[model samples]
Target: MNHSSLDSTMMLTSFGSFRPLNYFFFSLTLLVYLLSIFSNVFLMLIIYFESSLHKPMYIFLFNLALNGLIGSSTVWPAIMENLLSDTQKMSFLACLVQIYWGYFYLSSAYTTLSVMAYDRYVSICKPLQYHSIMTPGKVKTLLTAANIVPLFSIAILVYLTSRLVLCKYTIQNLFCDLVTILNLSCVKSLLVNLCGACMLASLVVFPCTIVLLSYALILTVSLKASKGAQKKALSTCSPHLITFINFGVAILFFAVYNRYSSFLPAEVYILITIDVFMIPPLLNPIIYGIQTQEIRKCFVKTVRKNEIFFRICELTVFRKSTSEHNS
Candidate 1:
């Protein structure tokens, strides 16, 4: 696995010498990555262990957690290595793979979110047929679509990207991402840009609108009911909404900043970090861990259980390092 280091991380712009505070940001980001790994793993395990959470919403949560785990794992390690290294020179192939996975989970998250919207739609709009419409077969079909639909998009974007000659591999952003990379190409990346714009629309715009519209209808239906009924309905879905916000806000921020910014100095760099790369992993687990009670309980229980197991292991250790030290 070719890992990219940070020494090659330079933009084509004039901000050639202003080294953004690397130690602080690097340490902070590493801590965030560790937290993401810890929390997301716990969440996935909890969803697996707790049968009650195997329903529509929590299942979506599980899928989201898993998607985040893989996506962040692919990108952030390389990012951290670059930040700390003297020279962050990522190989061509590694860069391509990174871009691929970035697009993959992004699209997957969109598809899953849209499916969740439809789940809500059926559950609310046609309450009588909710079970029938979102049945095992139907859910499986939806799952298949989620998996397959984005691959076609990725194939097109990546193909266009491969044709472009990379004149400057010095990426402006912290990580070698699609936006930063496309900016470095010699040819007009307008087609690739269009591809990105279209994918963003399909993945983010469409699903978010559906989620909003479905919830609007749901709210309308529930508002016509007793106070108790409305509260209960809202309570059931609040976690999913938070998840949507976590992913959606970052997506929105990136969509706005990337299109508008003319690759300005620190302005563009900071925006890319916050919106595209840094925030989503940090937010995913927190939103899920806080909002989903079952996940929270299971996570606490698992932590306690693991602590006990670690204590036992520490007592039984072969003490290989200590043995070497003593010798």
Candidate 2:
């Protein structure tokens, strides 16, 4: 491979034969992408204007929304082009960039999720010390660590994977995922697969375990507290816990199922991916804002104001048309 094709691993293997429903799946992917973008942006706005949302939980949430936006941008743009075009070709550098960015975005989000777990852990495990431990300055440090750790990890993974060059490029997934891309290597891949597996276990699997354990302890502690305090704790944690489930289950799909089996079809791959990338961003705002009375009222008022402005604009354009008549 030349310097230009630095790490080309596009091996063309039919995962079997294509089906007509591939188009159907791709169309659904298109819809999911559009909705993901719209919903994430709305969530971002709700956080932006709401002074009451300045807590660390909401800060982590804003980070997730931003990361989800970046992740969708990396996957969805190529996907849309591939679906519409006859030639579905991505350049070597371009593919590498996608792999890099996808890793970066996901790592940042995963780190944030882990930090969130510890935040809850402290709140429940050490209630009075929670304020001292989960301070804003500390939260910033956690966010920074979450973002930086992933960058270093991705740099190493990319460097390692680049050692193998493909005879030609063939990938089964809709976009350039690391798993599908790694399997594209023509060279022997046992060691690479092992290393990647370790990385997934460390990054994805371990963090999820932390979250699960944290929440378990949190629930246990809350149960020991007074009934009112227990109810309030449950209310606060429930939305985060549910969003975490949506995200965690999706990560599990990528970490476990996608690694073990190549037996599933492309549509199944797409759906699994959408579970992680598309659904959480769409669901988070609805989960949090709908349950929070103040946010729900603000959203309704915003909608009414927009509707009124739109009707006034239409009336202005359609007004008696005195100028047109004179002309």
Candidate 3:
């Protein structure tokens, strides 16, 4: 806990009380991580390999799945490792990396959802112009913007945080985040706080505004159209709406928890922290997979195709064995 050595290593004190349940936590975390990886990867591959799913809508869903995978991979493994380790110590450099990607994961998520809202808006509100507006090149541009903006923006925050003089070497949470690291600073920089507030507005408020506007337009258009059109719009936007609400709630709770951690119980704090990373990644694929007809159909077809292939292999093996015995 030497202040001088804070530059080399920092301890995660959150794991101290839960040391006795390390095995249980490790098992549960591993399960969730595995499930998250499998679901996201499966959804991504389905969208990628299926030629029919190459439209703007499916493409956006694919990116969302990819984002979930990246976000989950960024933190879950570290949590799993720390749970099982005797020393819940992370190196200074590593903590910064986690904070960087952690912010990237969250910001990119909102931005991607914003982009998706725009896609749905174009598709439902301007069906004739959907393809023209969301051209492959444009899609690439939007995706690039979704990722790069968050990356550079977060890099600045992390850089500012890196220059701070720390009064403490221990973080109270399971994984590193900007707020936790900033709390440990010996003296808070006004500029850093300003940048963080601006970041919150840019990363959260701006994207949310875009989502609202896009959906509002879609809603207006849907109301004026035929029942069939209304149904189509509802089906298309429902999954995205559900996803946005789920993520929005998690972010809202996270913001509140970080600001008011002093007033919250330890168990509430832990649950909020874990839920931020856990629920979205774990449920996104499920929501889309279950709600989208094309995805469900493709998944069933895939399972049947694999089953048939395996059955054919077994039959061939049986025939070969029978011929060899007779000979």
Candidate 4:
């Protein structure tokens, strides 16, 4: 096999067997992609327009929605196009670009969730100092760090992986993931793997640990508070918790799929990969909008206002049509 040929193009084997149902899957994927976009955009709009929601929590929520949009946009469009095409091949550089953006998005998602957990913890356990501690400057700094750290980390990983000579070009996943790309390296990359593992652990495990500890503290404080206070805390924290758990499960499935790819069937592996990209973006806004009182109220108010506006437009059109017919 020519090494130059391997360097030129890589095949994504994940969709090789789905040719028969490509159109069906394409339609379904497009719908999911659109729903994810709409949900996140709606959440962001509500947060942006509602002055009442200008607090730190909603600010982080807005960033989370934005991250979801970025993450979905990074992969779904390519996946949809691949579903419609006969070839599942991508250039080597394109694969690297996908891997970088995909991992960067994942890192940012976890980091944002962890930050949101800390925000809730501070709000609940130290309400008096919430404004003082989570000031606009601080929130801005935290958001900057969340994004920068991930970008830097993934950049290093991609750089190291890119230096390797390739022995293979086929990736057995739905998308170009770092693990699959690393597996194609011709040379033994123990150091690369170890460095990648450390990066992954830092990006994922550290933030998750913070989230768990913060939630534990929040729960402890909630136990001592009154029923109403507890209910309020629960209402606020539940959405974050649900989103975190959903994201955590997806990450777990991803880890398992990577480590034990041989044991799992191709279909199962494809579904796991799809779930990682699909579920969080689709569910986060819905969970937050329904579970958070302020968001839900705003959503309801917005919907009702839109309904009234549409009704007035309909009446105007009806009268105009009737007048034109009479004339």
- Supply every candidate's count of residue pairs whose N, Cα or C atoms clash at under 3 angstroms: 4, 5, 0, 0
> How would you encode candidate 1's per-residue C-alpha lDDT over 88-121 as one tens digit per residue?
6666666667778888877888788777777876
Error of 4 at 314 (Å): 2.4
lDDT of each: 0.71, 0.73, 0.87, 0.88
Model 4 lDDT per residue over 70-105, tens place: 888888899888888778889888888988888988
Residue 323, model 1: Cα distance from true site in angstroms: 26
How would you encode candidate 3's per-residue C-alpha lDDT over 35-140 as one tens digit per residue? 9999999999999999989987888788888888888888889988888888898987789898888888899999999999999998888889877899899999
When 1 and 2 are scored with TM-score, the better candidate is 2
Query: Each model's RMSD to truth, in Å?
Result: 6.0, 3.7, 2.2, 2.4
Worst 10 residues of 3 by lDDT: 1-10
What's the true lDDT of residue 191 in model 3? Answer: 86
Off by over 4 Å in 3: 1-6, 17-20
Q: Estimate each model's TM-score.
A: 0.80, 0.82, 0.95, 0.94
For model 2, the local distance difference test gives 0.73
Q: Candidate 1: lDDT of 120?
A: 70
